[model samples]
Target chain A: LAKTTQPISMDSYEGQEVNITCSHNNIATNDYITWYQQFPSQGPRFIIQGYKTKVTNEVASLFIPADRKSSTLSLPRVSLSDTAVYYCLVAHGAGGFKTIFGAGTRLFVKA
Target chain B: DVKVTQSSRYLVKRTGEKVFLECVQDMDHENMFWYRQDPGLGLRLIYFSYDVKMKEKGDIPEGYSVSREKKERFSLILESASTNQTSMYLCASILAGEDSNEQYFGPGTRLTVT
Candidate 1:
């Protein structure tokens, strides 16, 4: 498993775009970068995933450079409800594999 | 939306008592996992099951055991619950073959052992 490092916390305002970056210096070739969003007392929810380049979804966008060593999760037009902890994980497959979550970036969206 | 239901949302138990946390999935997902979340430890895998009768020990499986008797159910058992064992437990399920698909998680169970 590749080790991941991300910001401990971030602050953003409503209607502003927020980007959280994760660095996996030793990322594996077979690993896929996945981002999850979690609110207080609730389980983490899947946001977006990408191997390289850009992958966009309704909730977020994932940007992975060619090196695959780092990735960024972009949330468009943030709101107060978007205030939550975001986790960046590197997982291989869906065969009951284990995923390691970092301390996660705590995004506090302000009004 | 895939539904992974945990048996309890909150539980309070005493030390030395047996603890059982149940999880069931309605999507027929072949993989089920147990994880514990703490303040700074993030999410640590306790155990995972690939099939009905097969299980694999994860990074932190020493103080816990798991059982999967049916395809849709997985149970985490603490033989003698301890104070350190108190944490938020989360259950997750994913399809068997999707390599890049995301996992569906159930509302976590918060266990407090005193």
Candidate 2:
């Protein structure tokens, strides 16, 4: 399992773009970068995932550098409902992969 | 949509009491996971099962055990509950092989051990 580091908290305003970066210096080659968002008491929901470069979905975008050392999650036009903790994890596919989620970046969207 | 449901949303137990946390997924996924979340510490894996009757210990498995008798259900057992074991318990499931990009999580059960 690869370890990830992210900001403890972030402040953002409604309609602003929010980007949270996660560092995984020891990331593995076969690993993929995945992001999840968790509301107050709800379980984390899958946001976006990417192996390299950029991957975009209806909710967010994931950007990974060529070195695979770090990645960023970009949320466009944030709203108060988007206030939650975001987690980034590096994991492989299949066969009981034990994923370790670090202390996620808490995003507080203000009106 | 893949649905993961836990047995309870909240629970209270006394010390030395036996506790059981149940998780069920409707997606026919081959992998299920149990994790405990606490303040400061992020989600820590307790155990996981890739197939029926097969189990694997995760990062924090001490004082905890798991049982997977069927493919859709996974159970986490606490033989003797302790106060320190009080925390939010979560259940997750994912598909097998490369398509397992993300793990779907349950609503979680906040277990209080007194």
CA lDDT of every candidate: 0.91, 0.91
Q: TM-score of the candidate numbered 1? A: 0.97
- TM-scores for all candidates? 0.97, 0.98
- Supply fnat for every model shown: 0.62, 0.72
Query: lDDT per residue, candidate 2, B10-91, as tens digits?
Result: 9999999999999999999998999999977778899999999999999999999999999999999999999999999999
Pairs with backbone N, CA or C atoms under 3 Å apart (clashes), candidate 2: none
Residues A1-111, candidate 2: write the lDDT tens digits.
Answer: 789999999999999999999999988877888899999888988888888999998999989989999999999999999999999988875433888799899999999
Q: How accurate is candidate 2 locally (lDDT)?
A: 0.91
Interface RMSD of each: 1.6, 1.7
- What does DockQ give for each predicted structure? 0.68, 0.70
- Candidate 2 deviant stretches above 4 angstroms: A94-96
Worst 10 residues of 2 chain B by lDDT: B94-103
